[model samples]
Target: MMAMVTMVAFALEGYVNFVGMTLIERSANDKESAAASWCDYERKGTRDKVKDLRRMTGAEIDWNKRPYATIKELNELRNMFAHPKPQKPKVREWEAVGTDAEFRKQLRDYRPEYEERLTWEFCTRAYDDVEAIWQHLLEVAKINPFDALSGGSQGFELLAWVDENGRETRA
Candidate 1:
């Protein structure tokens, strides 16, 4: 569950950065890479991306405002689950057992109280918070997320108006 939330959060961060790059390129009329190559080279993280987004879009994306606020707590929990230090031996054990409880001993390591804390309701709430932030971003970017013709259970043709020599015309 922690892994799922972490993955979603990271993906959202990447998407936000990509949108920032797109806005910057479009506004400047520079047909360069849509994503920030400089930031990537420098290994800039999500906070840097958020700053870039704010600068490029001129929108105050107060992550502490609404749905995004939960992200900080979510990240903290994710880190705790991922890299539980020796100082918190119980947390480490919980993480290890939850990750893979193949053995009876591993299963026994997890207490009933821990199970109560890490319930289905808790997991879903965390996921919903991440999803809410994603939805908010989509709205801010004015991106229409759905295209019936593009994505579904059934696959569609890859071609986009093929010409005489099998050349593709997008517009």
Candidate 2:
């Protein structure tokens, strides 16, 4: 039943995972080559604080896990939408439809909890749940203010420290 929730959540936001992957690759680089990376050379003018965060808090992240998790979720969602859809015999008015006087009588069997959970309310809750997963993503990636579509203006703030020689220190 709960698995159904995860499936729907991913189905709804599968595009975000795609966008995030592209953004991460475009923004991130290997630690050794990071001096020339966008986050360093170009972005420093904007997110200069990230440099300090690295030096003081050692906030460097792996960056690989988040994309992997998002891709996995997208796969699960595609399966759910592409799989053979169960028949939900439509009901009519006037006299009625299906069997019982009630039109929706055919759907009484809720053995498969997933079918029961197919509601707007459930989808909304599922969205919140999936978003929660990414909360941890930002923390794990050590990337502050993880707004990918924000054009790099917003994300976790980086710390900066100027040593006695007035040189930037790497944390």
TM-score of 1: 0.52
| Tens digit per residue, CA lDDT, model 2, 1-171 | 345555655443443343333344545676445434433434332123223333433555332454223334434444555574775654433554566645565445423534553556655555664565455444544445445345655546567777999888974
What global local distance difference test value does model 2 have?
0.45
> Lowest-lDDT window of 10 residues in candidate 1?
147-156
Off by over 4 Å in 2: 1-78, 85-114, 151-171
Q: Tens digits of per-residue lDDT for model 1 on 28-55?
A: 5344543455445236555566566666
RMSD, candidate 2, Å? 14.8
TM-score of predicted structure 2: 0.34
